[model samples]
Target: MPRWFNTAGPCRPDIHYMLPALRRLPDVQRLIAQEGYFVVHAPRQVGKTTALLSLAQELTAGGRYAAVLVSMEVGAAFPQDVGTAELAMLDDWRNAAEAQLPPELRPPPFPEAPEGNRIGSALAAWAKAEPRPLVVFLDEIDALRDETLVSVLRQLRSGYLNRPRSFPVSLALIGLRDVRDYKVVSGEEDRLGTASPFNIKVRSLTLRDFTAQEVAELYAQHTADTGQRFEPEALALAFELTQGQPWLVNALAKVAVEELVPDISKPVRRADIEHAKKLLIDRRETHLDSLAERLREPRVRRIMEPMLAGLALGDVPEDDLRFVQDLGLVRMAQGGGLGVANPIYREVIPRVLSSTAVASLPPQTSTPWRRADGRLDMARLMEAFLAFWRQHGQPLLGTAHYHEIAPHLVLMAFLHRVANGGGTLEREYAVGTGRMDLCLRYGPDTLAMELKVWRDGEKDPLEEGLAQLDGYLAGLGLDSGWLVIFDRRGGQPPISERTHASDAVTPAGRRVSVVRA
Candidate 1:
């Protein structure tokens, strides 16, 4: 049988082209060797389960430890019921052992105990029955919430002193975040804000995304297997776009080879990847949609809203920053500033944010924006957008829930409607930048746009916007662009009364279409 890229679940080496899942975290084995309990957390579908599964197999195959990877996700259903969660968890553990380990390595039946003590009791029984030291990888440990989450972590911490004689020699909590970010339902919001009970953990480590070279190596595996080579430029572009995000790296190639250019003798090109990226974003597969779902989360919005609008991230908690980083939504850039992890994600964020507003747009909204040759007519598009904004922008703003970036979202929705299928709408915004840059590419023409907001007590921003946009247009090597300044003051007039446009020249003498709304 032939192998292919695995996207939906844990990778099986026998069937999927992959790098060693455990290679990303070299400390796991050392920590386990020292009998330490630690955490392994990363965003969804980045090979957390695959790494644990591979590590378990490697450890158990060494004939020194009896290791198995199980999931706490089964306990997620009984968030408020400690007893039921423990029961479901233990039941699943047994079934998981049967499926993941050989008979000689499998534990004896779990011993019964009080509801609060069931998990500790079960692990004690398993450790006692096994001839070898046992290691347990509990994947999705953060999936449990409230009392159930507290109960499990407490049980694990309680069992820490027993070592190999009465408890697993070493344990790992695997999930999307550290135990600190695990939901314990502290107070008002259903978000994590408190510390964890699992203080016994030695370290909370994250699985880093693949490096640029690893991405090349992984893609080369597909080339070696199917004789369908990815061009060098395609590989580099893939790394650039995905920033070594494991799922996205594989997903882009999977789409390119399987859907775009399946011929074994042919090579995949950079254009294929660009097309695949658009497809992936458009399709909003389960993985990307899962990311989209987080856009509404308060913790996520606290960071993303400001970051998206290119304004200062004021007073955001470090926990919030770490949580967002853990969710793979943002990362520290080269200069120690925060940034969206990758180019594809940069595109994904605004598109997802603008989705509702896009739907709110009137029918045939793009008709006036296109020229006879199917090109995006810049003047017409801007004129149409100004007219549309005067008519319906305020109401459509309600469709976008992020108040800080509502105006940006509304405009993106209209542009998305213009560039949806045949073109690309790319965005570049970061914290403290005070503006969002947009590159709308349709047909052979590209439109460079800068978006700024006129908040209460702020300067008019016209001169500053033109200065900033001059540099932006210079970067794009364009002789002209558009600068849109949105008036978001408290007592601003109605859209129809205030929205207008005029022509201006930047410091570089670039022709800029200036729109004030």
Candidate 2:
């Protein structure tokens, strides 16, 4: 009888703590009312299926259409074989209709049709037989690739002229990507460069992540259901960490209330939310794991590599940028720049990238950095890193897939090892910044660091590095930090011979450790 936060699939109000699914995407109804065929796309697990299913039920209940939501995912199993894919998809469609629709609203049997035209033919038969106009939301449409994908799109286009009376009055192709992105993924970008097979689409709409206010409303549902309340700080932190990602919004709450602090009498606090985030990232739950797995993707690395190293994104193709954005790996700011979509991803990206380097680390590397007081001794940590870099940094660079950011990745891997079990390392970088900032948090010790590279035809960058580390330290409310300048010019000495730490003062007179390697 209790309602809980839903993460796995479409929210069922009977047992899930959720906002109105249609509320997040009110424009969907307007598009349908115009009798348009369109696409609905967003990153995975952000409630695309939930919103579409809720809309189908709402429209059917309004008595205007016999609406149903079915998936093309089952068909994706036969990506190259259009005949088998269509057969599986139609079979799925029939089963979905039987389960969701009332007997009066369900279509009669699907008509027998040959391989190529089966989906179109069955849709036509259903549209003609229904008492009211039919509306269909095809989920996971982009899951198809190659010829099967092209066939599906063209078939939908083939039936475009016949509407309401023969074909569904309105239809939506729902997935993680827009039509053009699908083309790019399937290696047909050049062919579909000018026009997509699904060109009849009126517009491509994406579901937005929940606003902070929406996050509060969703968490409040749990409070209303039980006596537990979320402290105001916990609510703000959850939104800050997740930026109102639906699954993250729910998953954070689920972990906090269900596992971290399960007592109904205890209110969820800011610390609880923070710990929940740590647990989520550490566990690499299915959703986060899938997103992390994309870091090495060719399209993904093209953008992420420079961003990770805090360098300019040089002449990246528009679709490639959009492809990563569509995957939800990163988000574009209102003023037009790209960054990792949320803090959680920012954490996951480098962690995933540094995983290989971490494995290559000697076990003795972490031990030397930890003090008896359970604190990560910053001095010892840096000393261990200098030794590790001298010994293993060269080979570790080869382990990184992102060549441009290999040094950055190697350093993060060293820090990850130092903070292996009891510490957290946070990173901040932006394109054009020319620096990557890191914050390592142990029991009661905090170490702030800034990294920069000295390339050919460039100045020493020590003074600039000091200035940047000053700003970083000021933000962390610390009096000092480390500035690592990797001298990557044409004729630098070996890492072991050149690597050494020296003391310097920032413009603000904050003492800084300048490590030039």
**lDDT values, one for every candidate:** 0.89, 0.87
* Candidate 1, 373-402: lDDT as tens digits: 887778788888888899998898899889
TM-score of each: 0.97, 0.97
Question: Residue by residue across 1-517, what tens digits does model 2's lDDT show?
Answer: 9999887988899999888888778788889999999989999999999889988998999998899999989977886788999999888988999998999878778888888899999999999999999999999887887778888888999998999799999999999888877752354333354567898999889989999999999999999989899999999999999988888999999999999989999999999999999999889899998898877777778899999888899999888888888888889899988888889889988888888888887776237677787767677777877888898877888988888778888999888776766888999988889989999898888899999999899998998888899999998999988999988788777888988898999999998898886
Question: Which candidate should be chosen as best, given lDDT against the real structure?
Answer: 1
Model 2 off-target regions past 4 Å? 184-191
Q: Lowest summed lDDT over 10 consecutive residues: which window, candidate 1? A: 186-195
**Candidate 2: RMSD to truth:** 1.6
lDDT of 2: 0.87
Write out the backbone clash pairs for model 2.
none
TM-score of 1: 0.97
